[model samples]
Target: MTSIEPITLTGKFVTLEPLSQEHHHGLVDAARDGDLWKLWYTSVPTPEGMAAEIDRRLGLQSQGTMVPFATRSNTTGKLIGMTTYMNIDAETPRLEIGSTWNAASAHGTGTNPDSKLLLLRHAFETLGCPAVEFRTHWMNQQSREAIARLGAKQDGVLRNHSRSKDGALRDTVVFSILEHEWPAVRNGLEFRLAKYSA
Candidate 1:
């Protein structure tokens, strides 16, 4: 599929739409909830920052290195978050789900888990990728725990991986799910969704 084509991936509870201008306003509204970007390790902090972020992601897409999405809750038809496949190695059939942020309403709900299931299904089954990666700041306890719940194995920590927005040195926590591990990961996600729904 052409990278520019509007890709729509839906799971039982969430849908991922290819990032577009139409999604900008809704995402901004969703992000209006406070301190979103205040987290030292998170990418976004304000609605105004989204435009530049969107442009950056689109620029990467032009180079075939990233695909970003505006996450919507299928149940409520509300824009809830954003996610992306970054550092995409199409030749090696691998991509990373990073630069992710969710509205407060999305947390502790089925939105994130189901959103991930939809993306993972596309990455592994549709794209036929051999692996998928999920990375977070090493000290981001919430993100680290969420990644673990996805059944991804912690590969290792990349110390001094990058500079954080706050100018602090970042230690990256890397995790991955190999093709051979998709079955269990998929099942775990389904279970998590079920629990959320129940």
Candidate 2:
């Protein structure tokens, strides 16, 4: 039973609220932090287009294929970033965590790990998904390393996976955590969050 409520998922350091237009202003400010997303070619809507983008995401929600969220810092109760469970495949018990962008201030903090922890727990523990996927542009070394640090193994890159916003072919590097691997991944994420919070 999938529920349509705006479920709130909280971790020790961050909270995830279902995406809403109300998050627009905070997200607009958050986008000014740095060019952390400059190299990303496939990320959608962008800072300038976020308002309409949020509406587009909500449209996808009605199709049951994507669930987006506004990431908030628990300490300050400020919206600091966004993440999503996209490319959802309920029958295959899989989802992809992408379209994630964080403000400059929260990038290296405990926010990311805590956010992922909450989502991972929900997807694997509560929802009983067999696997959860994380994909990023092939050139995004920072993201690839971050995913690896979360204990997700590299699943190879799909060359020419899609066209980028800039009209270039994109290669997507995929990573995943299977149900059997959740224990180690979860523990590693928790440890990382603890270290960051400390």
How does model 2 score by TM-score? 0.93
Give the residue spans of candidate 2 off by over 4 A: 1-6, 35-37, 40-45
Q: Pick the candidate with the highest TM-score.
A: 1
lDDT of 1 by residue, 78-161 (tens): 888889988888777788988888888778878888888988888888888899999999889999999998999999999999
Q: For residues 29-67, what per-residue lDDT tens digits would candidate 2 score against the true structure? A: 777667554755446355788898889888887788889
- The local distance difference test score of model 2 is 0.83
53 Cα displacement, candidate 1 (Å)? 1.0
Q: How big is the positional error of residue 136 in model 1, measured in Å on the Cα after superposition?
A: 0.6
lDDT scores of the candidates, listed in order: 0.85, 0.83
Model 1 misplaced regions, further than 4 Å: 1-6
TM-score of each: 0.94, 0.93
